[model samples]
Target: MNKPANHDERMAKMTFGSVYPHYVIKVEKKGRSKAELHEVITWLTGFDDEKIESLINDKVTFEQFFEQANLHPNAPSIKGMICGYRIEEIDNPLTQKVRYLDKLVDELAKGRKMEKILRTE
Candidate 1:
């Protein structure tokens, strides 16, 4: 039987701009800087400052946002749970990408060292 649209499905349809404010709020509440959040996003998506700004200004959907992104090679190294789901194990590729971003932001908000968050050698 067909299932109802889940959060990921609904989220994919939503604009990244629409969701960005919430991310900013979440990190800011934890004392993380907006620059840090943007840094992480740029690291993961390979979106330069101008690209991200344009995407946000254009109100691109998550589906479109990721479609246009040049995901980092180490992005797969970002494995863990977020919102109760194992990001690495997510069956839907798009959902996995979205959760990967979420997990990174969560780590930043939790005060994880940037080196560890980026999984740098």
Candidate 2:
């Protein structure tokens, strides 16, 4: 009496990995509010931008460093993390084009393969 999660095992336990390689870092917390979403995901996964400004200038909050990173739920209040890379490889966006802050950053910056950036319409 416990079987519930089924959709790809609840999306691999919240976007951790079935493959490894998902890097999407679109953080715009509306009005800034001292924005520090885990230093914008360690500066878009490249890291070492002075260690994301010395770990977000020493305040550290974006839910205590992204709650150990690797997140999911890009809707019901917005979430989409893997803030380092994994959930199936990174850096996409229909190979590159679609703009206008891109619909959900092109669905988490083009994983699920983007499919011409989700039909762009």
Candidate 3:
């Protein structure tokens, strides 16, 4: 499906908190733990468990969530398709960052090793 022209704008306004639960469910149903999910998130965004909880409680938008993030230096290595978009090819920086997180979560759910998912290996 074709994304709307305002896709980036719409995604920017989406609350990270609203999407957090779905991520948890997706990973957990595949036998991954919530802690593992948090690890992936931390690897990408550098937010620890406490900070993540706070962000979830505060219902921060994706834009705000990323603004405060110390994005991992290795993030650019996260290449592939997510939500029908080639993450490396995305022109908008924010959208690419969001897709990076989605790709990490997808890898985790697919049972990839943590080191590989984090690009440590």
Candidate 4:
């Protein structure tokens, strides 16, 4: 899965803040609450509401966001297709993490139970 030469750089430069609203809208349109979205994010990144707000306010890049994240150990369990790529097959670690978030948000929008979305047995 060789990405374009500039893809990684572009993704690195894209601010998490820029994409936050889209995630919010995606879930909200499906009758999901913002709290649920935050919970999913916290489960993956270990960032609480305050830190997430700060990151959004500061316009942190995905690179910086993931760099500061204490990524959940269960993150590897997240699998499926997102944005035309398979999560487990993504060659780029950063891209994979980004897609993992996308996949979780997609699940939430699809009304998957929180327990399953969190991958808790």
Best by TM-score: 3
| Candidate 4's TM-score | 0.96
Model 2 lDDT tens row, 1-121: 2224453233333322211112223323232211333333332333444544554455443333344333322212222333322323223321111111123343433333333322322
Q: lDDT at 95 for candidate 3?
A: 88
Query: How does residue 116 of candidate 1 score in lDDT?
Result: 91
Model 3: pairs clashing at backbone N, Cα or C within 3 Å? none
In candidate 3 the C-alpha lDDT for residue 4 amounts to: 90
Assess each prediction's global lDDT (C-alpha) against the native. 0.89, 0.31, 0.95, 0.95
Residue-level lDDT of model 1, residues 43-98, one tens digit each, is 99999878988999999999999999999999999987788888877878888899
lDDT of 4 by residue, 1-121 (tens): 4568898788888999999999999999999999999999999999999999999999999999999999999999999888888899988899889999999999999999999999997
| Alpha carbon deviation, residue 91, candidate 2 (Å) | 28
Question: Candidate 1: worst 10 consecutive residues by lDDT?
Answer: 1-10
Error of 1 at 64 (Å): 0.3
Question: Candidate 1: lDDT of 18?
Answer: 87
Residue 19 CA error for candidate 2 (Å)? 6.0
Backbone clashes for every candidate come to 0, 4, 0, 0
Q: Looking at model 2, report the run of 10 residues with the lowest lDDT sum.
A: 93-102
TM-scores, each model vs. reference: 0.91, 0.19, 0.97, 0.96
